[model samples]
Target: MWRWILERLDEQFPAFDVDRWWGIDDPFERMIGSVLVQNTTWSNAAKALAGLRERSWLTPQALGSLSADDLIPAIRSAGFQQAKSRTILRLVHWLMQHGGVGGIIERQATTEQLRSELLSLKGIGEETADTILAYSFNRPTISGDAYARRLYQRVSGESLRYKQIRHAILDEIKTWADLARLHGLIVEHGKVICRKRSPRCEGCQLRPRCLFFDHAKRLS
Candidate 1:
C-alpha cells in the first residue's frame, strides 16, 4: 500500500514538494503555526500567521506579550480563535521560560521530550507534536491528524488510531527522506483524493491499490 502511494505520487506530481507549502522555515514558527492550523484550513491559518508576522508577533517575546483577547482577534479566521490564541500565548511563554529554541534543541531532546513539552501546552497534541518534530525540528516522525488517519484507514483497511498508525508507518518507512516525503504526500492526498466523503478515487494514483476503491467497486 505504501509503495503504491509513492509510485503514484512520483508519477502524477513529479515536482511535488513538502516544506515549501507550509511556508515556515523556522522550527519554532512551524511549531506555533502547527497549533494554529488545528481544525482549520491552511488559508485561514496562513491569514492568521500573516497577521502575526505583520505585528512582528511570530516570536516568543512578541507573542508572549499578547493577552488572550488581543491575540484572539488576529486568529479569528482560524476557528476556535480564543482558545487557539490562549494556547499560542501560553506556549510562547513556556518556550521563553525554558530558554527558548536553542535551549530546547541544543539539549538533544528526544522526540518524547519535545512532545511532552509541547503537549504540556494547552492545545498541542500528538498530531501537533509530531508535526512540530517532523516539519520543524527535522525529526523522522509521522504526523497523523484527521487527514492522515482518514487516508490511511481508507487505503489500508486498518483500524489503527493515530499513534498506532504513526508507529506502523514509521516502522515500514526506511529512510528519513521517505518519512518526510510521505508525510506531505499523505496530507496532499487526503485533501485531493481521500476526502471525508465521496473521495475522488478514480483519478487517484493509489486507486490501483486503495482498499476503499476496491471495496466500493466490488460492491457496485
Candidate 2:
C-alpha cells in the first residue's frame, strides 16, 4: 500500500522536488528554512531566508553573533518574529557548541543521538529534527509533517501517532532519496489534492483506495 501510494503520487506530481520545495540547496540553508517555516507558509519563510542571505547572515557564526532584536526585523515576514529570532539564535549557538554544522555532520553520532540533541534545543521538535536528519544529514528518516499524517489516516482509516507513521514509512523506504521524495510527494499531494477543506476527490488517482473518499461517496 505504501509503495502504491508513492508510485501514484510520483505519477501525479512528476515535477515534485524536495530541495526546490524548501527553496534551498545548501544543507545548512535547508536547516535554516526548516526552522523559519515552522509556523508560517513557505512563501513567508522564503522572504525571511532572502533577508538573511541579503545581509550575509545566513551562516551559523554570522547569525549567532547578531542580537535577537537585529534578527527579528529580517525574519518579520515569517511571523512570530521575536520568538523565531530567539529560536534561531539558540539553534546557532547549539550548532556551534556541537562543533558547528561541519563537525556535527562528520560526527559519529547515530540518527537517534542527533535527534535527541536537536530536541533538547528550544524550537526543535520531532518533525524538525527528522527533517534535519534526513535532508541535512542525509539520513533515511521521514519528516512526517501534517500532510503525511492526514493522508496516511485517510488512506488507512486509522489515526496513528507521528512516530508510528514515521516508523511505518521508514520500514519501506530504503534510501535517502526515497525518503526525501516520499516526504515531498505526500506534502504536494496534500496541498494540491487532499487539502484540509474540500479535497479534490473527483479525479484523484487515489480515490479508489482512499477510505475517506469511499466513505464520503457512500454518504453522498
Q: By lDDT, who's the top model here?
A: 2
Candidate 1: Cα lDDT at 35:
82
162-184: candidate 2 lDDT, tens digit per residue: 98889888888778898888898
What's model 1's TM-score? 0.88
- The backbone clash count of each candidate, in order, is 0, 0
Per-residue CA lDDT of candidate 1, range 54-118, in tens? 98988888888779898888888788998898888877887888788777666677777777878
Question: Each candidate's root-mean-square deviation in Å?
Answer: 2.1, 1.6
Name the best candidate (by TM-score).
2
List lDDT for all candidates, in order.
0.79, 0.87
Among residues 3 or more apart in sequence or in different chains, the pairs in candidate 2 whose N, CA or C atoms overlap within 3 Å are none
Worst 10 residues of 1 by lDDT: 1-10
TM per prediction: 0.88, 0.93
What RMSD does model 2 have? Answer: 1.6
